[model samples]
Target: MRTITLCSGKGGVGKTLLATSLGRIIQRQEKCNVLLVDLDLSVRGLTLLAFQNKYELDRLPFSLTDYFYLEDEDQPALLHDLHKGLAQNNSNAEESQETTAQATAGPSPYERLDGLFILPSSTESERPDWTPLHHLELNETIDKLGKLYEFATSSLHVDYVIFDTQAGLGSLSLAATTLSDMNLIVLEEDDISWRTALNALMEISALNKRLQQKSHSYFLANKVSSSMLDTADKLKAFSFLPPIPFDAWVQKLFAHATTAVLEKDFEQSDFFKQVESRVWQELAVILGARQRTTGNGPRSSWWRG
Candidate 1:
């Protein structure tokens, strides 16, 4: 399975949003299983979005926090339990409830969507205990994550493993970067964002060189206004994915909605259209998806676009 990590040097640049939207788009378009691993231990943005239904959030059997604290010998069993929990939850969701309206409400919050699975950061009531993570060695963290990666790919048969990492160059973010086939460094158009992004790029480059890894890295400018397109183009050190245009509707939706991708009119928005038509297509090619043909025959690559 190919792994991709979405990271940012700063917060609120839309890493979690991009990760979820990209996973949903790829899973639907490619007809393949995609697992989104929430590695943001502190914020847990993906976890919050995935478990919008409080029942599902409280019922989750295991999470990344639990996995990290477990002994190596017992860790794999937690994943097994996690898999069973997901299946059981989906099955239970199909059963009837007390209210007629509830019975006909369709799939539960945690029900499998096509083939999109989310491995949440934590299932804690208020906040996850991140103390243990700070004590573990960096390599130890990466090793544990590697095992999780193996299970997701071999046992779960996931085609893609997308990591939603913590903002900045934290241990979790670095670990995720080490394992990814591609790292998308998300940034805004502000000067601080750009400077931090450059620092992040340099760090990733140094890490890859030290480990002799060949992971590809790119810039993904988020919340770009029409006025900032020229500014974004000036970032020439690393290749860039198509910029996600600023959408006020999306920003508002994110504040009140569980996930922007699930909003009623989200798919009709220019943001979603750009992500579907441009971003995913570029990502699919990089992930080695076979070229697809449309009514107009094969489409051109991102460079041509």
Candidate 2:
């Protein structure tokens, strides 16, 4: 399975939203199973958005947090439990005599959309204890995450694994980068965002060089305005995806909507249209979901030094 990670130097750049929306789009277009993994243990943004129902969130049998702390021998059992729990919940939901409105509202956060599944970061009611993660060595964390990736791709039979990683160059984010086939470094037009994004790019480049891996990394300018497009294009020596323009409607919708992508209005919004039309096409090419002609093949390798 192909892997992609949406990472940023700081929070609030819309990584979780992009991850979820991209998974839905890919699943719908490719007719394949796509897993959306929340690797951001600190805030659990994707978890909150995906598991809108508190009952379901509390009922989750396992999460990335639990997987990280468990012994290697026991990891497989947790994954099995997770699969069983999801299957049982989905089966029960299907049998309910709920109204058509409720039924058509959209898939439950567990399986938010058909062929789209989410792996939450944690199931804890309160703040998760991150002390355990802090103690693990960097390589150890990557090894554990690699095993999780293998289970999702091989056993779960998912075609793609998209990670919504914690902001910044933290251990988990770095590890996710190492495992990803492509890393989308999302940023805005602000000074801090630009500087931090540059730092993040350098870190990823250094990491790839040290490991002798050629994982592609690209810049994605989100919430851009007409005036910002010129500035975004001025970034030196980095490949860029089509910029997703700022949308006032979406900004207001996020205030009340549990998950924007599931909302009917979002489908009509420019942000959604741009992602569906522009961003995914570029991503499909980079992820090998689509073929690149000989003339354009070198574009994929431009990310490397």
Candidate 3:
């Protein structure tokens, strides 16, 4: 499975919104098993956008925290079992819940979104005691998370796993970056946002080298106010970085609980046009997705997200 992470060095740049929207589009259009996992310890609310229903999974049975504490067995086995439990929980709920926050159906491998699944950070009420995640412990925990990601793709047959990373440069964000095959950064165009995002981009570049990882990542300039587009001519980053304008209609999708996917005129709005095309283009590069493009095009390689 290919893992894509959306991260920013700072918060409130609409990272979750972008991740959820991309998750929906990729799951529906690509016909791939998509798991939208939220690794934010502060607020694991990405599911609210899609799975508004109560995720009543007992906190004891499984959680990412458990894997962090129980350093007994090999990490792969522990995470594999946890993933299975989550899948079973969704599968059981499938019959009753016809429509999920994203797709109408239960939460199984075969649930509403054929090729999508989401493993949030923790369904538990309180955050796990991160005391155990010391320097060595943190490194090991990330190693396990990375292994879990590989398991999701190879053994479990998931097509894509998108991560809603914590809103900062921390251990969790580092873990997400380390495990990701491709990364995307969603940021605004304001001066402050750009400064913060530049720091994030440098971090992503350093991350790629540190892990000996190879992934094509990009930044999505979100809510591109007229000022940002005007600055594109000056800043090199803004030129190729896909810019998405503000759309009130798309904003409404997140305002309420579950969206009426069928009734929602996503096609009518221009929100999906530029952003969606760029997403597809980025996906193609990351996944080696075949496409007929103009020959002798510029070499495609990116270290920044």
Give all candidates' CA lDDT scores.
0.74, 0.78, 0.60
Task: Judge candidate 1 against the unseen true structure and give its global Cα lDDT, from 0 to 1.
Answer: 0.74
Comparing 2 with 3 on lDDT, the higher-scoring candidate is 2
Off by over 4 Å in 2: 71-76, 83-109, 128-132, 230-237, 292-298
- Candidate 3 lDDT by residue in tens digits, 15-130: 77666667767766777667777676456666444444444434323445555556666565665555454445443223323222323233443233445555655555544554
Q: Candidate 1 lDDT, tens digit per residue, 161-224?
A: 8999888877778888889988888999888888888788888888888888878788899999
TM-score of candidate 2 against the unseen true structure: 0.85
**Residue ranges of candidate 3 with Cα displaced over 4 Å:** 55-61, 69-112, 125-138, 230-239, 258-269, 295-299, 302-305
Residue-pair clashes, model 1? 0
TM-score of each: 0.83, 0.85, 0.75
